[model samples]
Target chain A: MPIRGSDRTSNRRAGGSPQRRLGARKRNQESLSGDPESCSPSDPRQVFTRRYRASIRTGQEPPSQRCSKAIHQGFELEVQLYPLKSQLVLPGDSLTARFIDALSAARLSARNGDIIAVASKVVSLSEGNIVSLRKVRTTALARKLGRKFEMLPEFAQVVLNEADAVYGGVPGVLLTLKNGNAIANSGVDRKNALGDSVIPWPADSHRSAERIRRALNRKFRKRIGVVIVDSRVTPLRLGTTGLAIACSGFKPVRDSRGIKDLYGRKVQITLHSLADGIAGAAQLLMGETQETIPFVLVRGAPVQLGGSYSSNSMTLPVKDCLYMSQMPSPSIMERDHG
Target chain B: MPIRGSDRTSNRRAGGSPQRRLGARKRNQESLSGDPESCSPSDPRQVFTRRYRASIRTGQEPPSQRCSKAIHQGFELEVQLYPLKSQLVLPGDSLTARFIDALSAARLSARNGDIIAVASKVVSLSEGNIVSLRKVRTTALARKLGRKFEMLPEFAQVVLNEADAVYGGVPGVLLTLKNGNAIANSGVDRKNALGDSVIPWPADSHRSAERIRRALNRKFRKRIGVVIVDSRVTPLRLGTTGLAIACSGFKPVRDSRGIKDLYGRKVQITLHSLADGIAGAAQLLMGETQETIPFVLVRGAPVQLGGSYSSNSMTLPVKDCLYMSQMPSPSIMERDHG
Candidate 1:
C-alpha cells in the first residue's frame, strides 16, 4: 500500500504503515535515542548532524531505530543509504569474497531480493581491466582529442582506444559511448587504482554484476540483485551522479505509463528507471573523489525483483536516446584542435 | 576523519572508528533481527529486506544505542534520506506554513542546521506561478516549436513564452532555459496542478529559497539550510534526477580542488555539487508520476552551511557550460519549421 500523510504524521517512531499483520517478526525498537541532538555550529559535521536531528524529529525514523536497513518489504518508505567503508581491493582480488566477508563481519547476508551496488572500479580490478598508461600506444586521433580536452596524452589515448565512438569534448570531460553506455573517459578511471595503471569499466559490467549476485546467492543460498555503477556528468550540471553500467535480477525501469496520478489522469512518459535511481541514491553516500566505499547496501527499495535483467534492458542506442542522438558525432572530435 | 576499511572489517557496529571518543553515548545494539530472511522468491520486498537484515548485522549501529547522538565532539558519518508525504498545495498557499504544519503534524520541528528541500513545483505554487493554457495565445514560433516537440499548441506557447531561449528538441522532450537552468518546457509542470492551469518554476527561485530560509529562521529562531529542487533528465540518460534550481545557506559546491585522494595525489575535477546530489537521493523516494511527497528532509549530510548562497553558485554562464555552449542556438530553432 502507498504510504499516507497520516501514517507519517502519527506519533509512532516507525511511522508504522498498516501493512503490518506479520506481528511475530516485529521487534520492540521504540526507545532508540539516536534521534535528535543540537550539534556545534563551527564544525560542519556538527552543523550537519544538528540540522539532520531537527529534520529527523518531525519527518523521519532515526537511523538507530532502522539501523543499517533497506528491507524492501514491497514498498518504499523510511530508508537509509549505507556506504560501507572497505579496504582497497587489489587487482584480481575476489570482490565477491571480500563483500561477503565484510557483510558477514557486519553480520549481514543476502536475502532473496537484496540489491548489491558495487562500484565499477572494483569489478574492473577483479576482472583485471586495469592497464598501464605506459603500455597504451597513442594514436594521432588520441593526441588531437587529448590536446583538445587538455588531458594527459596517455589517458586521452586510453579514452579514445576504449570508446565505441568519441562524441565530443567539454572542458576537463569527454562524452563517449563505451559498450552501449554513454560515459565520460569511456568508463576508464585513474582514481584509486593501485599504481600507474588505470581501470576500464569491466569488459561486461552487467555480467560482472550477474557473477557477483550468483556467488553471493551460492554462499547464502538466496536470490539477490546486483548493479555495477559508475559516476558520470549530467549535461548542464557540474559533477556526477551514479549511473548503472550493469544490473541483474530485476526490471530496471518502473514503467508508470498506465498508472494514474493523484488526479486520475493516466500518467504518460513517466517511466522511472529504478536501477539508475538506486545508483544515484547510493551516490549520495558514496561521493565523488573515489570514496573508500566500493560497496553500498540498498534494501527495501520496493523494486520489481526476480527474473534476471541486463544493463541493456534500460539502455537505448544513440539514435534512440533523447539528446545524445541530436548532438554532433565523432567528426566533432576529428575537428582541428587548434 | 575519513572512514577506514579496517574499521568496517573489525566487526564493530558504526564501523568503530578509533577516532571516536564519545564512548559513554555508544550503545550495544546487537541481537537486532531485521536482517535477511528467506521469503518466497516472488516476494521481492521480503527478499530485499531479508538481504538487508543480514548486511545490517556484524557492521551497522543499532538505533537504541546511538541515542540522542552527535557528540561532534566532531565529523559526520552515515545518513538517511527521508521523503515526507503531504497534501496537494493550492496556488498562493504558504509553502512555509504548509510545510511547518505538515512537519508539526509529524512531530518534527526545524532545528539548527537542518536542510529542508522543497520541490520547485510547490514553491512555484506558493508564489502564484500557475497560468492558464486558455489565456495563453499561441505565437507562430510557439506552434512550430510545439509541433516539433509533439506537444499541445497552447502548452507549446507557454514553453516558448516562458523560456529565455529555445535551444532545440529531441524525440519526447524539448530543451529550454528557464532562468539559468537548462530544463524541459521552461520548467512548467502540469502533474499536480489543480485545474487546466500549469505551474511554472518560481520567477526567481533563488529569491524564493532565500525567502523560505529567512521565513523559517524567523519562525523557528534557528539557522537552517533550504534548497529548492526540481527533477530533470540528464543527457544520454533516461529518467530524471534532482537538480538544484536554488539554494540558501550553504555552498552547493564542495570544492575538493586541493584535497588528497587515497593515493595522496591532489584531487582535481572532483568538485562535488552537494545540493544536486541530495536532490537525487531524495528522488529515489519521490518517483516522478507524483507521489505524495513534495518536501524532502535531509539531515547530517556534510555540507557547508551559513552566510547564504545563490543558485548561481552551482551554475555557470551559458558560454562556460559544457553542454549548452555547444548546442544549436535560437537561430537554429528559427531557421526551419518545414
Candidate 2:
C-alpha cells in the first residue's frame, strides 16, 4: 500500500492545530518544490517504486530546510545537529530559561518534535551539584581508592559517594556504574569547576531532564524531547562520544521485534537506541574544549514523540549486560588472540 | 588564533589541484552567502567573537550545499547523513563498483573528504561469506553448546570457529568476543540469507573497508574514508545501533590528551570514538528492516582526513576495556544496588 500525502497529513494533523496542519502542508510543499529531489526514504515515491516497503511508517520532520538530495526526485532523510552556544552557566541558574533565551537570541524557535540535547556538565552546574574537596570527609576505603587510582582522597570519596558500584580502573580514572550506566569516576569531573572541587553527574538525571522538558514544553507550547548528554568511553574504544544519561518526552528506544528483514524474516533482537545515537550526534558538535556549546538542537531525528517511559528505560541489569555478564576470566581471555 | 578562509583553503589545498581549490572557495562562498549565517564552528567569524577560542582547528566539509543557519551571522557545523538505497546485491558482487553505481544512479558523485559507511552484512554477502548449516560437521562440544543456547549444532560450530572467546549466553543468543569487539554469536545471522544458510560477519572487515576506499579513491581520485558498519547492541542498552568494524583513510579515533577544558584544566582520557559516532549516525538512517539502504554518505563530519592509521585504531584490548576489565564476580555484583 502506498502512503499518499493525504494519509501523512491526516496522521500528522492528529493532536495538531488546523493552523499547524496547514503550516506543515505549506512547508512540505515548499520543500518538495524547492529541491524537487529531496524526498524522504519513507516517501511513497521512493519506498514503493524503487524499493520494497517492509512496512508503512511515518517519521517526524523538523522545520529546518537543510537537506541533501539523494536520487533524482527522491526523498532522503537528513538528521541535523545544531550546536547552541550559551553564556557561562552558573550555579542555581535556570537551565530551561537559559536555553529558551539562547534559542530566541539566535532567532530560532523550538518547533514541535524538536530534540534538545544538553551536556550533563551544564545540567549539574545549574543544579549546584558541585562539591568542594575541602568539605569532603574521606573514608578509609576512599583513601585506599585514591592511592590505587592516583587521585586525591577527597575526590575518591566523592566518586565513591556517587558511584553505584566501584570497579577497578587504570591509574587516574576509576570505572564505575552510575545509575546503571558504566562511566568514568561515576561521572565525576573536575574540569570546568573551581579548583579543588568536582561535580558528580546530576542526582537523578532522568528527573532533571524531565523537569527541563516539561518547562520547555510549557514555555514553547510544543512537543519537544530533552536528552541529558554525557561523554562516555566505551569498552576497548578510545575517545568519548555522547551518551544519554537521561531522556524525556519520547520513547528512547525503538523495539524492532516484529520488523521484517530484507528476506521477510522477523528481527528478534534489534532495538534501536534512539537516545544514545542522538547523544552521540550531539557530542560530535559539543567539543570537550572551552567552547560554550552546551545545548544542541537535534532536528529531523527519527524518534516517536509522546510516550510515558521510565527514566531507566535504556539501562540493563548488570547481570544482563552483554559485556558484564559474559566477561571471561583473565586466563580464558588470554587464550584467545584478538 | 582565528582561522581565516585563506588558512582553511591553504590547509585543504595541500597536494591538491588548483582547480579544486577554486571549487572549494566558490562552494564555501556560495554556502556562506546563500545562508549568510552558515559558518562552521571553526569559522573565525563565529569562533573569535562570541565563543572562546580554546584552540584553532579546521575541519573538512563535503561538497554538499545543505547547512543550517546559526546565530546572528554565526557559523554552525551541520553534519549530514545521506542514507543510500542500493539494488539487491548478490554473492560475488563487486561492492566498490556497486557503491559507485548507486551513487551515480542517484546523480550524486563521490566528494573528497566524504566518509562512506557501508553495512557489513552486504560486504559479507558480496564476499560470499555464507555457510550452509548442512555442511557443518558439529563436534560434541558444539552440540552441547547448541542445546544450551537453543541454536542448531552447525550454527554453534560456526560461531565457535569465528569467536575468539565465548563467555556465556542467554537462551537464544551467545555473547562472544570477535576481533576484540563483544558481539553476539560472533556476528552470524540468518536474516537476508538463504533459509538453510547463515552469513557471518566479513572475516577481515578492516581490509574490506580499505579495499573499498582504495577502489573509490582510484575511481573518483578523491581522498575518501570508508567504514564497514554493522549493527550492534550495547551493554544494558536496548535496540541496535551502528558500529564501525573497520575504518580506512582517516584516524578513526581523535586523541584529546593535553586539550584544555572550559576551565583551562588539562583534559585527559578523552578520546572521541569518531568511527563509532559516525556509525551510530549512519545507523540512525539505515533502518534495521527491509529498507535497501546499505550505504550512508556522511558529510561535514568533524574528522581529520588523510591519515594512515591501522584498522584496529578504534579497538582496545579486552583487558583495557572498561566494562570487561572491571566486571565483578556474581557475588560482588550482587551486593551492589545499581
Candidate 3:
C-alpha cells in the first residue's frame, strides 16, 4: 500500500481521519523528527514526512515528551495509500493480458509520460520464452555437460535456447544472451514456477516496451512511456532494483554538466540516471513471487514527458558497466554449470 | 548547466533568429506525451504534462561540420568555472568567511529551496574541530587502548574528540556524533590536510546548516536550503556520495506510499531519499581538496521549495541501513587500526 505523510491540519479538519486521533493521543510531534534536541530551531511551519514515525515512537516517548509534541504540531503533509491485490504471473502473453485486464478493471488509463513498470518475468512470458523440460531430447553432449555441472539434461537445452554464445571457464560455461544481458544461465528461471518449466529472460525488452507503449496508447488514446524493468544484481547491494531493460517515450539519462552550484561553481560529472531511479522506485512495488502486482503506473515523476524515444538510450553496453568487470569469470561459469 | 531536451520540429523551423537558433540547436522544447514511434497518431494536438521523458539528449555535441559553413554555436550553458584561488587555511572562521567571499565574488544568489553543498573539511575548520597530535597528552588509558588495538596514542585523542559515544565494536568504536550522525571515527579526517593536524567531524552539522542558511538569507533577503555535506564511505559503492550531515529548509524524505502503479497497485516501499540524491549530485561538483570549490548551489531541481526542514529525514537508522548489518565490522575495525 502507498504510504503518505500525515496532513496534520487537514486530517484534524476532516475530523474523522484516524491520523488526527493518533496525533491527539500523542499530543507530541517531537518524536516525529526522532531527536528532541535538534527540533528546537526548526520552523514551526515546516511539515515532517516519514513512514516509520509511528512505529519509531511507540513506547519510546522519553521524559521530555512535552517539547517534542510542540515540535510535531508545526509540520504537515498529505499522504495517500494505494494497495495492490493478487499474485502476478510473469513472462507470458497471458501475464501481459492479465496486467491489461487489471488496468481496465481499476479504470486506470495510461497517460502520456506515465512510466509503466512491467516485471521481467511477465515480459519473458509474453515473448513465448517459456520452456518445457519434459519435451527436451537430452543429447549425449547435454548429458555430458549436465553430469559435469550437476544439472538436469533438460536444463542444458533451456540455457542453450536463451544463450547467444558461451565461453568456457574453470567451472563450466559463461553464457551471453542476445540482448547482451549476461547471466550465469542465460537469464533462465527455475525458481518461482512449477517443476520442469523454465523461463528465459525477455527477448528485446526495449522492443517489448515499445510494443506495450503502442498498445497502451491505442487502448487509452493517450501517449505514455513504457519501462521494461528487470531486477538486477549490483556488485555491492544485496537484493535489487528494476533496471530499465528497455524504454520508450521518455529520456532515461539527465546530464547536469555546466550547471552552476549555489556557489556558482560549474558542475561536471553529474549525470543523473533517471531510469535507474524510476526503476528503483518501481521495484518497491513489483516484488518477486509476492503481491503479484506486475505493473506500476508512476505519476508526478520529475522527468519531462515526451520526445523521440528509444530504449537504446538507457541501455549501457556491458563494457560500460563497472560492476560487471569485478565478477570473476570462473564464478560466473560455476553458476552456469551448477 | 541544467541540460534539457530540444524539440525536433523546432530544429526544422525556417528563420534563424538568435532565439530561434538557440531553440533549434538546443532543442529546449517541453515534451508532450504520445507514442514515440508513430509518425502521426490520433489526438496529435493533445499535450500532457509529463514528469520523465525517454529521449531527452544532453551533453555537448561537437560543433557540427555544417555549423562551420553556417552559424557558430557558442556553449549552450552559461558556466562560470571557479578554481580555488589559494590554499585555504583551516581551523578558523577565516575559512567560512573565505567561502562567503567566494560566493559573493561569483555573484551567485540563493533562491528558496536552493541547497548549498559544502565540504566537510571547511565545516570542520569553522567549528575548530581540529586536533594537533603534538599537543595531545597521551594517558595510560590512551596507551592501553592504542596498544590493545595496535594504533598510535594520538590517534585515540583524535577519535575521542570526534566521537560522542562509542558503540561496541572490535578494535575501533562505532561513534555516534554530537549531531547524531553515526559513523566510524565520527567522520574525522587525517589525509590531505597539513601534517599532524587531524580534522574532527563538524560539531552540530544541522546547526551549521541553519547558521549558513540564515546568514545567506540575511545577506541576500532570500530563502535557501543549506546542506553541510560529507563524502561518506558506503558499504558497497567504491566511492562516496555527498551525504547531508546537516540540512535546512527542505523536505529531505519523500513519502511515496499510496502512490499508484500503472496497474493501479499501491506502492508500499517507495520512500525517495531526496537528500541522498541531492547530496550525490552535489558530490559530483564538490570534489576532494584538489577541486578547491567548497560550495555548490543547485538549481532547477524538481523538489518543492519550502520553509519545512528535517535532518532526520536524510538519515536511515542503523536498523534500516541494509549495508551496515551486512558489512564485516571486524574488517572495518582492522582497517581503522592499520
lDDT of 1 by residue, B67-169 (tens): 3122111111445556665667787788887777656645456644567888988898878888898888887877776687778888877776677766677
Q: What TM-score describes the B chain of model 2?
A: 0.77
Best by TM-score: 2
For model 3, what is the error of residue A154's alpha carbon versus the real structure, in angstroms, after optimal superposition? 22
Docking class of 3: incorrect
User: How does chain B score by TM in each prediction?
Assistant: 0.74, 0.77, 0.65
True contacts kept of 2: 0.42
Docking quality class, candidate 1: incorrect
Top candidate, metric lDDT? 2
Poorest lDDT segment (10 consecutive residues) of candidate 1 chain B: B23-32
- Over A2-50, each residue of candidate 2 has an lDDT whose tens digit, in order, gives 1222222113112233354355455554443333354555554543322
> Chain A TM-score per candidate?
0.75, 0.78, 0.63
Candidate 1 ranges with C-alpha deviation above 4 Å: A1-76, A104-113, A221-223, A332-338, B1-76, B105-113, B332-338
- The model with the greatest DockQ is 2
Put the candidates in TM-score order, highest first.
2, 1, 3
Each candidate: fraction of true contacts kept? Answer: 0.27, 0.42, 0.00
What ranges in model 2 sit over 4 Å off? A1-43, A46-74, A104-107, A327-338, B1-74, B104-107, B327-338
Ranking by DockQ: 2, 1, 3
The i-RMS of every model, in angstroms, reads 8.4, 10.6, 19.8
Tens digits of per-residue lDDT, candidate 3, B41-135, equal: 22212111111221111112222222221111111111111212223546667544665565544434344434566777777776787777899
